[model samples]
Target: MKKGIIYAVLAYLTWGFLPLYWRLFTAMPAWEILAQRITWSFVFVAVLVTVSRQWRRLKSVGSNRRSAAAIVLCSIFISLNWFLFIWAVNNNHVIETSLGYYMNPLISVLFAVVFLRERLSPGQWLSLFLAGLGVLIMAVQYGHIPWVAISLAVSFALYGLAKKIAKLDVLLGLAGETIVALPVALGYLFYIQSQGTGTFTSLPPFSIILLLLSGAATAMPLFWFAKSMQLLPLSFVGFFQYIAPTTSLLLAIFLFNEPFSEGNLISFSLIWLALIIYSFVTFKKSKVKVVPISRADAL
Candidate 1:
């Protein structure tokens, strides 16, 4: 549990500071950044898998055609999510992007209750209602629904849904997503290069290094996240996931100096209230249950 807690914290911290890293590419096109992230992430994830002897696991999943196809479809969704997020950060929509992540847990809870037929407590229902109200307020603030935020949330939820169904090992599943995205990223990079407007060609050496590091940067936290998931319960991991967005919110507000209007404060407050209720409900439910201790606990 100690190891898991440490890994989880490290993973969220890395994710929270991602804006600092990606901001270096602000002068570049979002698509360009997305392309490099995919290409480099593929290389990094491949190496991690190979070093960890997880490659065999990939082969096993590959042999399962249904799982492979599902993963491929989900990979596309995640790539879209990634592209949107990078675009949001570069386009001064970090707060909106943070809002998307803030909505994620509530979205997941809804999915669990509706699709998985999981039971929900009254607190959970109230939490969802408050979250809906918050979203409504945001829509009013923007004079339209924030599609970028919604897309990020929906695409990621679908991606998580795919991951649950794929049932492949973590590293192998990630390798699949990167592999699916690799060709498109390479094609885009080459096309941009041919146009003589490629960021890669014009970037300084340090920028290039950072861009390359983006791959490992992206992969490393994910590796830690997977490790934590192995050691922790789904509920604990689900809660830990919120740390990333909370950190992102801080970065967006203070570090990035994004505008924080009264409406934003109100909307964010509602979201937090909703999250509190959701956590309380979940915790209450948890207390009513009993779990057997495992061999690891015996140690």
Candidate 2:
């Protein structure tokens, strides 16, 4: 339990600060940065697979068509989520990014009810309604839907759902997802390099080093998150999920100085109220388990 708590805190903290890291590549294109992230993440995880001798497990998973297909779905959603997040952060939509993550748990709940036949309490339903209302308000205020925020929320929620379906060893599963993405990532990177638009050639040596290190930066938090989930109930770990978005919201408002208008405030407040209800309900229903996670708790 202690280890799980520590891991969850670390993962959320790292994720919370990730906008700052992505901001370093603001001068670069989000596509190229995403390609770099995918490529390097694969490299990083491949090395881990080698060192930990998980190659057989990896092969075993690849041999299974259903798990392999699920991983491919994970790769697609996660890749989209990664690209959208980087683009949003670099393009000064940090607050929207924060909003997206803040709404993720609610979206996950909806998916559970819709796809998994899971039941929701009355409190949960009300929470979902409030969150939907908040989103509708945001759309009305913006004169269009906040697609960045919605896409980020939905993509990641789908990624989580796909992960639940994958149901393999965490590291091995991650390795498979990256490997599936590796080819397209490498292809796009080469295309950019050939077109002379690649940051790899034009950026400072320090930036290049940072770009190379982005792989490890991308993977480590995920490893921590997986480890934590393996040691804690989804409901308990889900409680910690708020840390990332809350930190991102603070950084967006105070550090980035994004315009937080009255409408934004109202929308966020409603969503927050919804989350409070949701969390209280979740906690009331949750038991404090001692680090014996089950397959049912995979996501």
Candidate 3:
């Protein structure tokens, strides 16, 4: 349990601090950065697969068309999520990005009800109500939809659902997704270079190195997260999931100096309150005491 807690904390901390890492590539367009992330992450994971002699697992994925289709869909969703997040961080919307992650668990619940046909408890319904109210408040306050937050939450939730249904293990599943995305990423990089708009050509060595490091940044936390989920209870893992967005919120306020309007605060407060209620209810009611399952348990 202690080891699980430690691993989960480390994973969340890495994710929380990722904005700072991506901020290093602020000179590049978000698309280019995203492309590099996908490409290099593919390369990195491919190397890991080779080193671990997990080639058979990759081969096995090719035997199932349904799983391949699900993974392709998951890849699209995750790619969108990654691009939006990087854009948000670079474009001074880190707080909004944080809001999306803060709202993700609620969004997952909604997805479960809608697509999975799972019934929600009364407490879960109330939590969703509070979360909806928070979004409405934020929309009213901003005089527009909080699309960044909404998009992030929805895309990631959908990605999680796809992964859940596909039932692929973490490393192999991610490898499949990245491989599916690899061609598009490479093609984009190629086109950009041909157009002379690519950042890679003119970037400083340190910046180039940082871009390469995006692969490690993408993979390591996921590995830790998968390990932690294996070691811990789902409810406990769910509770620790808040650490990432909480850290992002702090970084947004103090480091990036983003304006936290009064309205934003109120909306966030409502969401946090809802999460508290949901977590408490879930912990209290969950009595199965089953071991955590290993197939993409969380996003």
Q: What's each prediction's TM-score?
A: 0.88, 0.87, 0.85
Which lDDT value does model 1 have at 136? 72
Off by over 4 Å in 3: 1-11, 224-241, 287-299
In the range 1-299, model 2's lDDT, one tens digit per residue, is 67988998998889889999999998888998999999999999999999999899889889999988998998999899999999999999888888787667667766766776767678878877887787667667667678898899889888776766556688987899899999999999899888877777888999889989999999998888778767765544654666788789889999999877788788878878877898787657654422676899986
Better of 2 and 3 by TM-score: 2
Q: Model 3: per-residue lDDT, tens digit, 22-106?
A: 9998889999999999999998999999998898988888678988898899889989999999999999988888878776766
Candidate 1 residue 81 C-alpha distance from true site, Å: 0.8
Q: What is the lDDT of candidate 1?
A: 0.78
Model 1 C-alpha RMSD vs. true structure (Å) is 3.0
Model 3 pairs in collision = none
TM-score of candidate 1 to 2 decimals: 0.88
* Rank list by TM-score: 1, 2, 3
RMSD of 2: 4.4
Report the error of model 2 at residue 253, Å: 1.5
Find the 10 residues in a row with the least total lDDT in model 2.
Answer: 282-291
